[model samples]
Each structure stands twice: as C-alpha cells, then as structure tokens.
Target: MESIFHEKQEGSLCAQHCLNNLLQGEYFTPVDLSSIAHQLDEEERMRMAEGGMGSEEYRTFLQVISNALSVWGLELILFNSREYQSLMINPINEKAFICNYKEHWFTIRKLGQQWFNLNSLLTGPELISDTYLALFLAQLQQEGYSIFVIRGNLPECDAEQILGIMKVQQQQRPKLIGEDEAQSSGQGSVLEAGPGVVEGVVDEDEEELRKALALSRQGMEVEDEEADLRRAIQLSMQGKALLGKQP
Candidate 1:
C-alpha cells in the first residue's frame, strides 16, 4: 500500500538519514521521552491510569522506536495515517518493514524496556523542535518558523546560538529579511508556539525582595526602613546569580 508520507521529501530524507546514521552506529538518545518515562513507573502508572506511561498507548509508542533502532536501525519515520504506520529501513537485513504502529510499539518492548537515556548523544535541535511542536500542539502562526524544547540546565545565553544553528540547517532555504512595511503590506510571518520557558521565571529579584521584607519582621532592629532597602538590594543581587544574569 502507498504510504501517506510517500510524497513527503523531507520526511523521507530525514528517515533515510536517521537510518543511515544508526547503521554507522550514530544514534542520539531521546531526552524528552526519557523524562516522561521517569514518573511513569509501574506504581505511578497504575495510579494515573490513562495518562501515565503505564498506559498501553505510551508503552507501545516507546517500544516501537526502541525495537526499530535495535533491529533495522534508529532512523525511522513514524507516520500517522487513518491507521498508524511505520516505515523502518533495516540496515542489517537491507529491507523495509511496513508495520502497523501498534505492532512496532509492541516490538520495542521485546528489547530492553528501559527508558532511552538522555545524557547519551542527544537528539538534534530540529528534531527536538519537531517533537516539541507535536507534543505541545504549538501552532505556527506565521510562514516558516519552528519551535523546540531545551533542557532546563541550558544556559540562557547559549540557547539562542544552539537554536539558530538548528533552525538554519532545518530550513536550508535562504533566509529573507524585509522591512516591517513588507509584513504590513503583504509579508506574513510564521509564528510557532513557543516550547514554553526552558528556565524558571526570573523572579529572583522579586523573591529576594519578598524575603527581605519578611526578614524585617525578625526584629533585627534595622536603623530604619532605608536599611531594609539596602538589605533588599543585596538579596536581589544574590538571586540574580541563580539566573546567570548580571545585576
């Protein structure tokens, strides 16, 4: 049967490249899935029922990817059709397996059922963004933009640099920059739904101030409210360090 994704060039290329990389023993660990799985252990799974990883849907999905990587190769395109479908190119057997998604999911379990490690070679940014868009239901409000999730540990200064490289490669076409007037007149921008904040909300300064105000009730005998102000500034500076920002 003709796959629904047969005509999609990027999808095919991505699948092929992924499979080829896997054959060369070049595969990246899937961090997002790993994170999701940690909280879905058997005890937690039974508690949550449908939402947790214990659910049939989640387990099946995880297994399918794992098994495909183990046997055929890691490079795969999991396509959604009226029925779930998978096209996995096996590097060892030099064959393609067209299987139902559910079956593929079952197959991965036959291999080690542990979570995919995160600290291992991580997935590239483009794929990461694709995962974010799919999982988060981020809408692209404009013409040609994408979104991806970054680890909480990623430094804010480096996020843009990493994301920029990924975006450029994912979109091989030349970038076009035009005046605001162009957009107002006819140019349209593609605005993708953000991957949500990677780091916590920058409330260090505010939190510091709150703490300082609370400390005032400690009866430290501040010379005056002005002394309290100075203490607040100091506390705020300390909080700024947590955010990796200069005060």
Candidate 2:
C-alpha cells in the first residue's frame, strides 16, 4: 500500500524503486537499487548510464525481478494490452501494475476496489478512474504503444501447480494476435478505423504502419528472449552464491 519513489535517482532506478515499494514490509525480502542494477547486462548497464531504458531493456529488467521474486514464492505475470484490460475488469488481489505512458514508466496498485497511480515523480498517490484508465488504454492502442501488466504476490505453490494455473489462464484468455500476422492471415485490420473512415474500412497507409510496427515488436521479442536467457544465467549464479559455491 506504500509508494516508492526514485527521489534523486529518477530515470535509471524507476523499476527497482517500484519493486522495492511493492516488496517492502511484505513477506518477501525487499531488493535495493544497487542489487537490481547489478543484474543488468552490459548493454543495459550502458543504457542505464546514459539514462532511461528501451523496451527490451525494461522487459529484461522485469524478467530479472520476476526471477528474484520467484525464489521467494511470488509470481510475476506480464500481460499485453488486452490482457491488462481484462484484469482491470476482473480485478485480482495483491497485484500491481507497471504502466508505460509515452515511454515513461509508472506504477499502479489496486487496494480493495480503488486503483492508485503511484508515480515516483509525483508527491503522492493519485486516484485513477476506471473510465480514465480505459480511455488512456484506448489511446495507447490507437498509437500502437506497448503496454505491460505485472501481477505479483500470487499464492506460493509448487512448479506443477503454477504451470497448471498458467495454462488454464492462457486457455481462458483471448489470443492477441499481431497486426502483421492478422493481415497475413486475411483478418483485415487490428485497430478499429478512426472517425473519418467507414466503420469497416482499413487504410492502406495505416496497414503498412501496423505491419512495420509488428515487425519492430517481433524484433524486440527476440531481444527479450535473449534477455531471459541472460537473466536465467544470472539467477543461476545468484542461487550458487547463496549455496556458497563459486558462480
């Protein structure tokens, strides 16, 4: 319920600050900025030094945090825009969000029925309306911006139970197909045409943009997969360290 801010360490430590806030006073041990920063790969470290994180770097950072939290019986579920909207509609307990608005990241936590935006740059938590959230999301969708939802603090369970739960969730959720894939499969368009266009009309230029964006997103996903591999190695090293073995 408490918020964490970067204070003087704005750009580089936003994700770490957010994680620290989420885990502090909880059953799990809180992680510091230095510990989080230490896990970054060489490229990410360079990105941090220059200020701000790109999409892939941010995804990598989340994976690192997820791996760390898993060691302590917590879950971190990353959701796309559609999944995020579904989550908002059917709110879950003990979950938090790391939202990207125009490439700037911030946190949103749900306490009871109210959603609070715990932006580090802000002095205090700001109340967020469901309508506002929906509209904001719609805008992001229109702009083709990436949205990520991170749900944490799930009930501690064994790997099998976790996998089963995830499988069931995936089956129940709607499949979000990429624009390029949808187009290639003759699905027409991804986003609904704007006011000027006819209800079902798809613009040629818009379609091309969507295709380009989809390709770009695909490239980022590859980078994210590599990041996952790196984080897995990092987590393995951390585990060995805890066991008093050389990593």
What TM-score does each of the candidates earn? 0.19, 0.42
Backbone clash pairs for candidate 2 read none
Give per-residue CA lDDT, model 1, range 90-188, as digits (tens): 222221222221111101100011111110111221121222222211121121111111111211223233433443222321111121222233223
lDDT of every predicted structure (CA atoms): 0.26, 0.41
Model 1 CA deviation exceeding 4 Å by range: 1-21, 24-52, 72-247
Q: Given candidate 1, what's the lDDT at residue 179?
A: 15
The alpha-carbon RMSD values of the candidates against the true structure, listed in the order shown, are 21.5, 17.9
* Best candidate according to TM-score: 2
Off by over 4 Å in 2: 1-11, 24-33, 36-59, 81-94, 101-104, 140-145, 152-247
lDDT (10s digit) by residue, model 2, range 135-226 = 44444434433444554453332322333333211112111123334345444544332221212345654444343333322322345445
lDDT of 2: 0.41
Report the lDDT of model 1 for residue 6. 15
